[model samples]
Target chain A: MTVLEFDRITKIYNVRGAGQMKALDEVSFTLESGRTLGLVGQSGSGKSTIAKILTQLETPTTGRVLLDGEPIPRHGKALRSYRQQLRMVFQDPFASLNPYHSIRYHIERPLQLDRVVPADQVDAEVRRLLERVRLDADSVIDRRPHELSGGQRQRVAIARALASRPKLLVADEPVSMLDVSIRLGVLNLLADLQREEGLGVLYITHDLATARHFSDEIMVLNQGRVVERGPADEVILNPQDPYTRELRAASPDPEKHFATAARDQGGAR
Target chain B: MSDALLTVRDFSVVYDVDPPVAAVKDVTLELRRGEILGLAGESGCGKTTLAYGVQRLLKAPAVITSGSVVFHDASGADIDVNSLDAEQMRRFRWDKVSMVFQGAMNALNPVAPIGRQLEDVFEVHRPAMSRAKRRAEVAELLEIVKVGAARARSFPHELSGGMRQRVMIAMALALRPQLMVMDEPTTALDVLVQREILRQISQLRHEFGFSVIFITHDLPLLLEISDRIAIMREGEIVELDTAERIWTDPQDGYTKTLLSSFPRLTGERGVVVR
Candidate 1:
């Protein structure tokens, strides 16, 4: 089933004196349940604009976003309901979390505001969510954002996003700021969550390697248009577009290229 | 290779917090003339701290406990960067050693034109140069970094992230400094733009004959661009070897794990190997 769909979405930003900037032009795609759609693009390539349109942070200049075969309302109770069903995870963990609030408050505030559970049971639910994100509830429940590592903070952010049990997750460059050692762990966690919770995810990133590793379907965006869209492996391995090929070639691979160079130089000479 | 441009010997940085956390511990490395030494590690591995310590860029509450950052001047005099006073350090910075920081896209003054920023670098380092000479030099610098001279008239917000980074590099290279410290110089850019920037840096290093201290968490990028690689873990330098060796024969398990964790683009088909 199509959990979320963007039908011919177009967003234009107009400066005071400058002409309109076409951020997203006639972009159309569908996000099904229990699947991830990876959006790859360079800076200013309309990936973030799509995320904004879906989250209702910004309305599209044209077209509409449908949730479960119905158009999302512009205002009133329906809009709030749509927002509650879709949650966003920002790129920077440091900026995403409130520095002053403890982890418990950060996790529990969303639950309380959304009225996910009774007031007294909010604490227990927060603890369970923390555990679900693989964080030790006892050690991290009272700690502030500053006290935790980047990986831990991101996990907490994920837990906070999952607090209200949203069906769709819009993670924008979620692992770009993290260390490589822990990046895979987070990606694996997201993959596992999608499988277990049947969540539909729109993972936006510029890193094609991670997109190939994580997403089931991939869309290559350049200049606010979809250049190619197919299975993640096919799009990565046999990319038809010149931009996708260039992006693939530009990605650094230490094991293959470096090893080839080493062999040619007779083992670093 | 007779005279090393920058020598970091037994360097250690400690954050004077409640537990007195050590960020960089007993790290030692050397950068020869015209060579690029890449520092590769994950976040919180002290690579940035080491970069700041080399140029004495650390703020208060962060203390350099031991060792020295010695730079060999053009006249063959060894100067300890850690011991320099505020005024001396100011003169040493940008003139002798400059840094192109991470997220250099946002480093520019949003309101100021790019030409003025480039001119500011020249004005601080070469105070004797005339206005005409500075303007001409700014154009030349921008051209060398592949950012057209026309962009010098535009504001920071008008330029793309890659263009902004090129402008930052142009500004850093304006003085022809002996050593340049780049911390994740290409992280803010896309893969193709990153390649272009790295290729420009490689070519410029060959032409300018200046050593580079490159810090980044991307191991494969470091392997591609660096002559030597230093792997840091926790707070210590776990392994330091040639980029080729670090790729094929890493000495530390942490380094090995980091290399393995990277997702390769060209590999076994249809398998999500992480």
Candidate 2:
């Protein structure tokens, strides 16, 4: 089943002195249940714009978004209900989390706001959620955001997002701010969560290598348009678009391919 | 590459809080002329702290507890950066050694025009030069970084992220410093833009004959560009070797684990047993 469908979405911003900017242009894609769609793009490629639209933070200029085959209402009671089914984990964990609040408060507020559990049961649910994200409940519950490391703070953000028990998740460059050594661990956690919860995820990133490893389907966006879309492996290995090929070639390789290429040229000389 | 252009010996940085915390401990490394030295570590591993220590940019809360950073100047004078006063250090900062910071978007002033920012650097450092000569030099600097001269008139907000990064590089390269310290310069950019920026930095180093201290967490990127790689763990340098040796035979367990954590595109998934 299609958990989320975006049909012909476009976003235009009008500048007062400058002309209008077309941020997103007629983008269309479908995210299936229990699968991940990796949206790959550069800084201005409308990847973040799509994530905001999916999370209902911003309305598209022209298009419709459907959740489980029903159109999401623009405002009022129905929109609030639709929002309860989707949640977003922002790119910057340091900025997304409140500095003054404890981890327990951050996690429990979402549960209480959504009315996911009773006041007495909210503490237990928060602890369970913390454990689900591999954070120790006793050690981490009372600590503030400043006390935790970047990775730990991100895991708390993830737990807070999962507190709603939403069917769909939109993670916008979740690990880009993290260190390289811990990035894979977080990616692994996200993949495991998707598998266990059977949640549809829109994984947005500019890193093709990680997207290829993590996502079932990949969509390459360039200048507000879908340049290529297919199975993640197929699109990465056999990229049809020149833009996609350039992006792939630019990515750093762990196997020292460039050094070998330089060595081969030297040997030939 | 010859004997170290910059030698950091037994360097340690401590934060003077209510209780002191050592950010960098007994770290030692060398950067040769016209060679790139890559510093790799996780967050809070003191990579940035080490960079700040070298330039004496660390403020009051952070104190240099011990050791010295010696820079071999163009006239063959060995200057200890730690001993320099604020006025002397200001003169040495951009004229002899420069820095290109991460998040070029935030580094540039939003209200100021790009040309004016570049002119400010020239005005402070090279006040003897004529205004027209300064403009020509600014245009040349922009051209060297592949940014058009027309962009000098535009504000920081008018340019894209990649373009702003190029402007940052141009500003750093304006005075033709002997050494450049880049702290995660391309982390905020995309893959293609990152590659382009790295290639430009490599070319600039070749043209100008300045050494580089490149700090980043991306091992693959460091392997691609650096001549020597130094792995930092907690508060110390764990391993310092050539890029080839560091990749194949890392000495420390933490270094090995960091190398193994990178997800491979064309190999067995998670086969890198730490």
Candidate 3:
């Protein structure tokens, strides 16, 4: 079993005119192969920073990320292996995918790069990966990203991430770009894959409802600080920090009937 | 006299391609006086197409096939929108109806200061207004959306995503138009900011009494703010009713599926998706 530990990571970005900005501050958390951790925050709350740190897109200012109690390799074959173990599913599938390439080429690139299967079996594995994501392999494999719907394109992206057979998946707002009707579908597909494959997932999003529902644990971030972290229900239903509470109040609760329709609409918020 | 602020009959938008795909097929709708009407649908379901068609904002390749849009002015003047010429259409747009689209960067000019851009709205629409009055109005519009007046000096790039969206909203509100058609205005914003913006929109409607066509794929948000909701699917409006009814007892099977798409904060999760 794989255990990833993020130890006291701090990332400070040197903004063009603003000099320096702390994107993350002394943030630390543990992710295990069999569980999911929801990283919840607003746009500039440093949620993406954590994802960047994990994927090695940005180096930490003062801390380290350890996989199985060892520091991650910086470069060469070890770095490639580290990447194979940790994969990312970006938010915008439309932009993430290339318009020119067919879906087969997109998924095949990852499989070939990782050598997930031999030459002759590559075609079969591509079909299998597409099927695993619950997409109709025959219908979509030959089509370009533009030909597919937002949901279908996202499913293909998930299939591509799973192509590496990673131990961990860093999904940064995976469904936020898709239409609301199709968001839950992509999310459920991710959750099902996590359950079936025992892949540790860092589900990063500004949405609390989905986080509480899908994650085993929820970590709240505010302006680069980890304000609260606990069991998903505890963190969401009974938030300790004011930031989390504010976030909860802001999110439109589908079950909470708005008394605005009844009254003068003063407290619709 | 009808209580309807706007009436649309037999509206359809067809793209001129080989087979000629109908993006919006005969969508008949109405906006009640001073009510927030929610247009909910997935992407490519023709929600945007209907909004664009209503405002006559749609350009070539996509043509309005069979439709009539009539705007019922509060002064008892009924203006048939489709017959207006270019100059008349321009004057009618911001003066009678304003639209906030996705509420993002492309909505504003990156080169000019926000203050100048807001002033330009008055210059172009209300040509005779004094410079000082335009500046004061810009500040007031900025205040209404809760953005600091200091942001007026900054360009679009200098402002945060949420701030830029609020500025777009400020621009939309400048004309005091009878109808505001906002297409996914808060979709890109964070949840906290989104709620705040919605609250502002709701409050502003109460204050100004301008009717709104709030379009988004987010159904729950529609339930929160909209008095009535319209559900569109495959270029046609399948269901249109009070928001409460849409939420509690969705009649159409497609509406039921759309309602069940979101993961609820309470109760059993994913009634359909799971």
CA lDDT of every candidate? 0.89, 0.88, 0.90
Clashing pairs in 1: none
For residues A147-244, could you state the per-residue lDDT of candidate 2 as single tens digits?
99889999999999999898888999999888787788888898889888988889999888788888889999999999999998889888999998
Steric clashes per prediction: 0, 0, 0
User: Which 10 consecutive positions of candidate 2 chain A have the poorest summed lDDT?
Assistant: A254-263
Clashing pairs in 3: none
Writing each residue's lDDT as its tens digit, candidate 1 over A1-269 gives 54788999989999789998999999999998789999998877899999999988899999988999899998987787778789998999999999989999999988987899999898899999999999999999999999999899999999999998899999999999887888988888888888889999999999888898889999999888999999988999899999888788788876567667758888753
Candidates 1 and 3 compared by lDDT, better number = 3
lDDT of 3 by residue, A1-269 (tens): 99999999999999988899999999999999979999998889998888888989889999999999999998898999999999999999999999999999999998999898998999999999999999999999999999998899999999999998999999998988888777877788888899889999999999888898888899999999999999987998899999999999898875666554445566443
lDDT of 1 by residue, B1-274 (tens): 3568888899999999998989999888888888899998887889899888888899978999998888989887889888899999999999998889898989999999999999998788789999999999999998999889988899999988899999999988999998899998998788888999999999999899898989999887999889998888888989999888887678899888988787776665333422
Q: What are the interface RMSDs of all the models? A: 2.8, 3.6, 2.5
Candidate 2, residue A209: how far the Cα is off, in Å:
1.6
Best by TM-score: 3
Interface RMSD of candidate number 3: 2.5
**Model 1 stretches with alpha carbons more than 4 Å out:** A118-120, A259-269, B1-3, B16-18, B74-90, B268-274
What pairs collide in candidate 2? none
Winning model by lDDT: 3
Candidate 1: deviation at residue B181, Å?
0.8
